[model samples]
Target: MAPGPAPGPPGHAAPDLATLTGVRSGKRSYYRAYVRSDERMQRAVRAMDSISRALVRTVEGPRGLLEEVARAAAAHLDASWTILALSDGHLRGARPRFLAVGPDGVVTDDDAGLAPLVRRELGAIRAGHATRSDDDGPWVRVPMTLEGRQIGSLVGLHGLDAAPEPGDLSVLRILANQAAVSLHTSEQYQAGVALHRRAQRLYDEATAQARDLEQRTQELRQAEQRLVLAHQRELIDTERHRIARELHDSVTQYVLSAGMAVEVARGEAEELGADGTTILERLGTAKQLSQDAVEQLRRAIYALHQSHRDTVSTLPELLHEVAEHHRPQLQVQVRVEGDVVPLTTDADHEIARAVGEALFNVATHARATRAVVRLRYRADELLAAVADDGHGDPVELSRLLRLERGRSADGRHRGLANIETRIVDLGGGIVFRRARLGGVRVEMRIPLPLTPTDRPGVISGLVGTPGDDRDDRSGDDTQEDPWPR
Candidate 1:
């Protein structure tokens, strides 16, 4: 290759008026060839400038530098094809791809077709700021040098008809060198963008997985809860059967035996007189005791029955309704006060039902003419109290605490033991004393769990806020532990 004008076949002068296929004659043909050659040079120069601009643009955006530069150059240079390949690696356009123009107007920039030696030479040429070539002169790789460093190479074909000029190749080299620098910057940016996209996709996937996992965990918890409830019901059913058997074996037999003895004494009364009468009286007492036993057994069975709707039980409504239900004969007044804010995540339906049971006990056993059923909700505690307008007898209260059997002053049955046991299980306390109305008052207080807040929110009662205690019972409030059960 030489640095000079390209040569063509000599032109022949002919008659000015001569005519031929799409031409006047010899002189016109020569003029056409000269114009074509000049156009080729102009196109090559424009292509080089386009390559420079394209490289710069690729660095600024997502477009691959090599692809943009090579494709543009091929079009501008009026070549049939163009390709850009990386000097550093294979067919990667994002990595300093170099352009090559063939004499036949065909370009092969595919990294796959490029020879390994050529690729190595391009890399060296870019790094060392020098050009290298193979043994044959047909292929010449012009190094694209910038700031004393060869970023890559530009190769052009040489044939017998066209001997590559040094000046033209140099021009190509300068443009290629500019493209190489721009491509290097663009490649770095491209790699960074790829990394960022990968990270964002991972983050999104992780977030979706977390939500799915949480949903699965909740489903598992629900399934476990159902299993526990079913098991509990089975146990209750077994207990009921056992209790029914006990009642038949003990209380029923005793009542039947006592009746037989009374009948026998009546039959012998005429002969045995006073002794027979005494036997009959003793049998009567025994029968009465047997009947009382039957009643107690029934109550026990009622307590043992398992509820399927346990989860849906609303303690306050149940309590208030019980008080009102029994208000007619007992002259009991049902008063519901305070707040019991329901929590969505709370699974303590048993606790609420237990509270309801306690209220039921008050109406049944307290033997009061008037009763005040209070359900108070403070920030820190939930309290319920059933006070009665009955006699001031602390003896019944003591018996309830001891869970011992003692006849009620009114000669009615008492349910104090069950009530006390339920309240104890609620982590609460109870106080039994004379009310301001001059009658026995049974007040029970249970602490509400603290809601999530910066300060110990809602210390007590409905008036409880961050630092308020409007419902803390004064002087007569007693605290009871719920774990004894």
Candidate 2:
């Protein structure tokens, strides 16, 4: 029309100076078009900025990021209402599967507060009845896709005077696709956190169970040790009672029979008058010695026969029983000078045997009439002493004990040797001293905190006659004996 617009090259449109010059070319129609294009670009820039902000808002979690995306779409389309929803079967782990923004720009996960059109659109999206919209109606729908698969839609009802262009639809698609990728990432993060919590709980339970098992194992070990000790004690007691039975049935009867023979000989010697005087005197002495020997054998048998079950479990109570056995022939008294200390059962038995040996020597070789056994408990050691009123020399007895220990085992002074061995095995010492009661005093110093060795039958083997065989001696000749020949 003004020489007409020059025909542009082939299919290219004629360039508009209004776009290059902006407001400087004040033609009314071109200015209006320019203003429209500028506003659209500004809205697109704002929409892209919203997507950028939403992408970085992962710390606010999936729901917050989704809401931000919804608001960005609404602003881009200049919409009065908007809906963002995942299809029912898609992104099942994503929370708040549906999101709605009202005309008032209020965000909500539930569709109840949305406008009727917005709520209807959300239901359609959730029910899979809606897809990306391509109509010229006021409504616009774009798919939010992940890896090219449509998971949900971003729907909007615009309130603008102009319809959204193709460029506007492109911005909405970008925003929707970004929201899909972000939601998928949020679902994975949540799954990892839940798995970590469950794993920690199982580890704690396993640790507690292991600790309980260790404690029970230690208790079982301690119980096993106690059972072993108890079984050993039972065996020792059974052997002691057996030895007692043999001594009483065989050796005791032989000594009594020998005493009877001596009495008969003395009566025959008396009938011969002065011719038999010296022989009668010798027979009387032999009879007295036999009686003494019989009393000593009875005491030994009584001690061996005493059962551990029949008495209290204390050293003083055991010493009292030993004193009672010796009381018939020699007046024996037991005194405890301090508080009683507990010791191993085997150690107590050995100490009691040592004290009984001392009393036996007092009754036989010491020629003592009375004896006292004292147990004095001290800070570091136990003082067990046996004193008697007799005519025995301590020096001679101590010398004999040293000689017996130094020499070979020939069955002489076995009692003194046994006393030394018992005390020494218990980490203690023994001494023979002059008694305040006018005879020999045997003192045994056993160290305190006495945990005796587990040797069960050591002291039991030392009982009865030193050299004689203990196996059934009832058939042996009683006339060929050591009682004054």
Candidate 3:
């Protein structure tokens, strides 16, 4: 037998029959030991699995994660009841502070339905009196520590025959510490969410306040513009009243006295017979001219006395009024050809006065029977024209304007010069031509989108430029008669 069992393999020797028979008889004992060892290893693995599962429950919040931890400890030790509680003044933000799991796997955050032993362990852990590990009694206590400081305890009451081994205690400690860290993380997450909500609310309130402030600023600007316009109108009205008083009290009286002297002279010339024939005719003409001058002065006084506040506020309405004033003396038609453009109050007033002046020339000097006042609004400019059917010559008028501008500031022969000045001050030029209605046409071209520089107060340095006033008429009818009489 020794030779048969020898040298079974390299570096090995086979056992004898007696040794093999002894092993066969004690097979049951070895099998039982092996089975016990397998069960212990499986229990350790399950405990590790539970700890891993509990650690990842941080997203579930502190209360939920703590409950899972208590359940995991109970399952690991096969405990009749388990308690997990934070020590007093530790992890104060960790809600519910205490968590318990019964034998039936029911988890409760309150202590009302807990057994006496479970309640007592929870009270001790919360009171900060349960610090030491107890592995000798039926109740096992393990401290949940982080960085060498104990935050809480995990206590379990088991009905098992043996106390937990060193390996089992290690698994329990890991689960407890992991639970505490996960709870702290959950508390931090909640704090961040609350802060974000407060920031959003404050941003919304700030945006609303900014919008309200912008609206109030716009309203104030509009009110200021209205006040400025009212002030300008008041000044204009006051000046008009003063000029009317002067014309009525001074100029009208002088013209009337001159007319009376002319009448007396005409009566004395009639008594000189044939020698006084030419003198009588000349005196009669002078008397008639004086009467006309007095009549014109009276009309000016009446117009200046009328308050602009009682009249319409728009340019078209004012133009119509001007046409009405001349309708008695001549056939005048006002025609608007395009969408009316709104201009500043002063600009509109100046434009209307220029148009009125042209019409007055047509009525008094041009000896026109009919006239057309046209206002054409173009994309880039405005065309205001007064065309008349009369014996007026545009060439003579242009020459007169050049002559008048060259002379010193004299009140005489200022009608045409005044018209040129008004249009030029508004960034415009004047043109005179033969009208389709058989006489003169006075046309003004004003650029659109007028700026502050084009207003009345801002004068153009090239105002009296010879190129601004041009005669477009082909054949010149140079009549000796005074222009703009």
Q: Could you give the C-alpha RMSD of every candidate to the true structure, in order shown?
A: 14.9, 13.0, 10.0
* lDDT of model 2 at position 330: 90
> Judged by TM-score relative to the true structure, which candidate is superior, 1 or 3?
3
Q: How many Å off is the CA of 99 in candidate 3?
A: 4.1
Q: What TM-score does candidate 3 reach?
A: 0.61
For residues 74-154, what per-residue lDDT tens digits would candidate 2 score against the true structure? 998888787888998987788878777777888888665666656667777888775535453488888888887888999
Tell me, by TM-score, which candidate is best.
3
lDDT of all predictions: 0.52, 0.77, 0.75
Candidate 3 or 2, higher lDDT: 2
Span of 10 residues, lowest total lDDT, candidate 3 = 458-467
lDDT digits (tens) for residues 403-452 of candidate 1: 44444456444455545545555556666666654556566666665233
The segments of candidate 2 whose C-alpha lies over 4 angstroms from its true place after superposition are 1-27, 50-59, 112-116, 129-137, 219-234, 247-401, 412-485
Tens digit of lDDT per residue, candidate 3, span 1-485?
Answer: 12344467777767665466433333466655555566666876876776667556656566666776777678778898888878988866667777888878988887999877667777789888764446445888889886788888888887655777776788788778877787666667767878899998899999898999999998886576555545655666677788888888888888788888888887888888898899989988888878877777777777766766533545677788788767877899888766676665656777888999999888889888999988776666777889999998989999998998888866676778889988888789898988888899899878875545533341123121111221222212232312232
Q: Looking at candidate 1, what is the lDDT of residue 113?
A: 55
Worst 10 residues of 1 by lDDT: 456-465
